[model samples]
Target: MLSPSPNSIKKAFSRVALVGKYQADGMQEHLGDLAKLLGQQGCEIFIEASTAAHLSLTAYPTKKIETFAGAIDLAVVLGGDGTMLGIGRQLAGSQVPLVGINMGRLGYMTDIPIQSVQTILPQIIAGEYEADTRTLLAAVVLRNGEEINRSLALNDVVVNRSGISGMVGLAVKVNGSFMYNLRSDGLIISTPTGSTAYALSAGGPILHPRVAGILLAPIAPHSLSNRPIVLPQDIMVSIEVVDGREIIVNFDMQSQTHLQTGDTIQVRQSEKTITLLHPRAHSDYKTLREKLHWNEYPSTF
Candidate 1:
């Protein structure tokens, strides 16, 4: 169902890695079936070590997620967006591209459907696909002007109250200029790739991946006047936890750490990036329409 990009050269993908959702029931059969499919394509299949341990995938070689950078040419993910987000963060700066076989409810990043993998995946491995490069956010937590924690978030960086009953006061600054001071549940600083995630849920505008902008949405701001704003992607945003009962910071909703009141989170564009491979014919609007169920006509109409 997917076609190769006409503009791309025929690249060799002799080594392919398969990462599957280990928590799924009957995942062994799913991974086995896919491994068999890739093996038939004359490819050397490498299973992720963590996945190999969880699933009974001993038939293929295994590689750790931390060191598989150059050994593998391409990675095929068999999970939903959450899995992709985790892998994407880990694979940042690897320069290795990824193709996803969607197995989750909302497959924004993992766009390919499992049912279509049999038909669409082979063409992709054979070097017929479009490469969509997405940027990432690099965040560092500074406690007393000393770096304490650092992480990369492909989706968003959320700083909010830890418990159910409390408000966190935050001071926001963009590019060294004071932006605002607010008391709210927390804040969402998201990349364009993250606009559709928590940013959208928190009443933030959806920024297209191509847009070089970062979205800032306050969670339950005490003042209704506090509105979401989009910032230049290149600007460095510094948010300091002023006052709150308990504050926590999250990277891509995957890794999180508790923070002190004086902690300042500095977020900037990461030098590392992620490359997602899709069919050459893939359209952003089409994915949006299908995934979001847009442009539907009423039965009465």
Candidate 2:
């Protein structure tokens, strides 16, 4: 979590960034409306140059993803989690607070509704929201002792077979300690913030955001006895491509590259974190029960 400094309130914003799914379903017209609304309130809207070109809007001038970090106070992402993820990569090291507006279904991260942006924009500009700092995982893929790809993830780092019918073997280690060898579709190394995502589908536990740990779960493990394991946040988890003629490494929704045998990936807690702005009263448990349709085993009634 981000600690409020004495100057925190003074750091309240007048300039904001507008981000949305490029070519999102039914959002193009609304984007222009949102920009007009925010502009009416004296907020400067900074957008990606590509998005600007895509929309062909003249009033809402834009900046490149690289320059957006230094130019805005906060980023309002109008779409689902994937849109937020794309923006997160651009703002990763900068520690910019991202407010997600849900324009899609099953939005675990993007919580705000389109109709509420105008109502909530003022409060957010006034620093009336709480910030949840979600830790990220950094991964480096190496082949033949050469670094092939490096990326950071707000969700999970996955290694699996690429369209192959056969299961892949992944060797795992935590803090230099041997964990297990697994024959599965893939492996997921996720933070507590991502437990509700693909990890949950693999039988991993849903973790509270404040929890300082990581979840390692196997995707469709051949051995039914294999289960998700939680580990201390400080430990480094390593996965090696043990076998398979073809494999792939993925960070969140983006796939990095195809991997040959003898490739290894090192995953650890990233030094930088993503700051997510939430309504003051947002509750993780409530979100889960509602969004995930997770019924309480026995109702209190």
lDDT per model vs. reference: 0.88, 0.81
Models 1 onward score TM values of 0.93, 0.91
Judged by lDDT against the true structure, how good is candidate 2? Answer: 0.81
After superposing candidate 1 on the true structure, give the runs of residues whose Cα lies further than 4 Å from its correct spot. Answer: 1-11, 104-106, 299-301
Q: Enumerate clash totals for all models, in the order shown.
A: 1, 0
Tens digits of per-residue lDDT for model 1 on 183-202?
89999999998988898889
Model 1 lowest lDDT segment of ten: 3-12
lDDT for 274 in candidate 2 is 79
Residue 75's lDDT within candidate 1 is 90
Worst 10 residues of 2 by lDDT: 3-12
Structural RMSD, model 1: 4.0
User: Which pairs of residues clash in candidate 1, taking residues 3 or more apart in a chain or in different chains?
Assistant: 4-128
Q: Write the per-residue lDDT of candidate 2 for residues 1-301, one digit (tens) a residue.
A: 9855433433366677777787886667878877776666567777767777776766767877777666777888888888887777668878568898986464778888777778876677777788888888999998899998899998889887767558998889887898899999999899887898889998999989889998998999999988998999999998888897677888996757788777889999999887899777877777788787777566874
RMSD of each: 4.0, 5.3
